[model samples]
Target: MSDLRDPAPYDALLLLSFGGPEGPDDVVPFLENVTRGRGIPKERLKEVGQHYFLFGGVSPINDQNRALLEVLRKDFAEHGLDLPVHWGNRNWAPYLTDTLREMTDAGHRRIAVLATSAYASYSGCRQYRENLADALATLEAEGRRLPRVDKLRHYFNHPGFVRPMIDGVLASLADLPEDVRAGAHLAFTTHSIPTSAADASGPAAEHGDGGAYVRQHLDVARTVAEAVAHETGVEHPWELVYQSRSGAPHIPWLEPDICDHLESLHAAGAPAAVMVPIGFVSDHMEVLYDLDTEATAKAAELGLPVRRSATVGADPRFAAAVRDLLLERAASERGIPAERCALGALGPSHDLCPVGCCPARAARPAAAGADSPYA
Candidate 1:
């Protein structure tokens, strides 16, 4: 459906991602970078940083991104797709601004950004675009050459994104005891955003009303469940659950936390459960701490069998999917509307995010929108 042979509109690919601390020393600084303008107190930040501290002050995301980068590079080479790839993070070293400066100085223009996030929610989508815009503004102020940055479309429903997840769910189910396999439930987990933001996700969001954010997750959960049922003939019942919610309790957020859902399933006598982290691309800190540590502990207490499936980290299929989207976008840039691959009903998201799509704050610059900042 995509042509890996052409990358005319894009000179280089930037793997834009949410950065994490590499070590204990980087924890506070990285946290500060993430919460810089939000005025979050050091005390609260320290509380949150403990999660990273527990894991030796490192978040698995950076290294995971590195692995993905290598895979993308290797896949491109193997497929004869000659495109250079660069990386930068929003909250850590090799920061976005510095990366942009480096790319511009290296004489690369018409950059295509593939954010690690694959959905349409605020944090997953808009915030990253805003981060890219801010990085561009900083570079512009520093007298750097500006590159036209276009983001790839959301791939929540894309088969490249979904197939691996189905495999993951099936693997997790197989891990359950043979006696319990037929009755296992699926808990599809994702990061929980504020309900207001969730409502405002995607185009023209107006309230905490479950916009594209919830819809996309549900579509994926259903698609995976249906496919798993078809393959295993087990008809696993599944629910979309939220995780890593950090806002004040007064501010509503996506709920039925994974652990809580596990408790309910246990009480309801579900023989076993598979924790499919369909929401995340990697076993990031949230997946590591929240699912691996916290939720696993809860399941143990309930005497419920559980297995947390691996995320799609550097899966060859996923890397190829990225290539497909890149080529598709490049083709469209040259006036060819290439066919897209999406497993769920939503299909592929907009190449250019519609105006008012996934706003994280009341005011901010965003790229790939109507009059995008990158434009």
Candidate 2:
């Protein structure tokens, strides 16, 4: 595992993500991109856009991604890994197609992509692959050559990601009133998807149908909770909960939205609670709106003290993790036994998705040369 590639094989690293609006004017259009396929009316979208408007129509995701890009660039340079890094999004300016075209034009033939999402659900995993397919098709239509893109393995269990959540939990615990902190329960939160989609996620294994998604999140939450308890000597009870549900009411997604859980905890006489967003890589709109605004307000109204841990953004450890992943992929490509890091032990994600992994309704034929791992 200590053996490293003499020279990195990757020519570039692409940071792929779901883009967000940068200002009040961009909110409606951003929502449109998110809901393009869904037949939801414009009026309903406007109402939803109000969430972004509340925060000056800016999504922290893009900025966070930019910060991550800079961190990766600096880390790579420091390590003498001369790979140039680029950023692209599914929607908004600097679209994936344009970014890929730029990279191709710049003469990058072999590239690696690191998606912002860290889980195995359809939207989290498969959709990114589909987007890559679409981008490649767009490039072909424009008579442009597409580069070979390989996605990094998911890093949910990596110390770089998980340790930050544990640190966040400890900080949140310290912010609470002393007595309340002692009695605080921990609630690990993630975005909710339809139960069916969760069931169809990842390769079949002994862990159950949606094993990949569910097990990854559970492990992250448990690891953070255990580390926090060990560090602070607080035997806080914890549970995983869902947030930012947007589907039809009757269709069940993940259970116990953060607000509802807070109310229940309050009614059950829990003095305070801390929410750790184990399913997210950064504090995007969902984290800002759901946890910071909605859940906090609910807890306040119910006389329950609540605190949310910070998302991993530009953490040095995370930068190191990304570097390690690239090295592992490069070594594997060279027929070397890939060294197992805390993150790499999760195993390399599928370069080409397995049949029926993360099945989507109205599934379209996958475009050729899609670089997404899910594809």
Candidate 3:
């Protein structure tokens, strides 16, 4: 049973995200957490930590999550939704386990999680589920009654999520010189996962060669591009690109890195370009360093005009979308027919991830899915 205003069956909403370093001292440790199982050396991690140091050793993700929490709370209040929103990160302070323990201590038995990642991939979806399982296991070890957790469907194509990106692209295009505005090419970018992982993303059947990761990004890019053309009356040439690639150089990941893509565009004599980060929910380290600092520098060197569009960070519309998602899922859980809103080719993603969805390299327990052990 559920209360319409309270979203019963779900007493709390957890905002889960990939945490980042808050200061110079936290950088190496944060990186260690991110690459725990990987046997990368500490020196290499410190070298990688230069990106954080460049930005005063602070990752914008934590603050962005804080702002998002504030907006989600405000939006919930305004809309009469009574669910309390809590923030947690997989790798940093206010960690997922601690937050879940806090929720349990407060007597929340049913919880809904909204990961900051918008698309489906091993890291994006299943890893978070695994973390949830880990947290629940820890609670069980401590003799706490673990809560049942459900993850919200992927919102990459949700109108609330897509619309802000569209507006951002429009704004970036407007910022370009009038001469190049009509001819500017749109580069839709996302984080580059290993090719094998991308091949295995989403449900086992639905995702084909490139898997759901690539397919989802392409869908968002096409939808946004088509909308931009419809509004501006110029069909700007666009292609899905990848950024923020990490891991062994020998291992293949998504290709045409944004910097390399920029070089290509410059060589091809494109007047200008706009980078649309459809992959990230907010302007985190990847968006800031990979695109803004690194790729922007590359574009500058190539004498190419480029503007990085904004991510949907704490946008009121996104907050409203979150509210809509919580309500929609709540109704569905109660076996009531609820309007599932989505834009673009892909309809709403599955409410619960199927077994074998986004399989990890080594199988681990995951919560909030059909394969979740907690259930």
Best by lDDT: 3
* Model 2, residue 261: C-alpha shift (Å): 0.5
Candidate 2's TM-score reads 0.93
TM-score of each: 0.97, 0.93, 0.98
Prediction 1 global C-alpha lDDT: 0.88
lDDT of 3 at 119: 91
Model 3 whole-model lDDT (C-alpha atoms): 0.93
Q: Please, what are the lDDT tens digits per residue for candidate 3 over residues 1-375?
A: 235444877899999999999999999999999999888899999999999999999999999999999999999888777789998899999899999999999999999999999999999999999999999999999999989999999999999999999999999999999999999999999999899999999999966677999999999999999999999899999999999888879999998898889999989999999999999999999999999999999999999999999999999999999988998898889888888899988898999999889998897899999988888
lDDT per residue as tens, model 1, 197-288: 88888888433478888898999999999999999977888899989988679998889999889989998999889999988988899999
Q: Kindly indicate the candidate among 2 and 3 with the higher lDDT.
A: 3
Clashes of each: 0, 1, 0
Clashes of 2: 1
Clashing pairs in 2: 353-375
The ten-residue window of minimal lDDT in model 2 covers 366-375
Ranking by lDDT: 3, 1, 2
The TM-score obtained by model 1 is: 0.97
122: Cα error in model 2, Å = 0.4
Residue 55 alpha-carbon offset, candidate 3, angstroms: 0.7
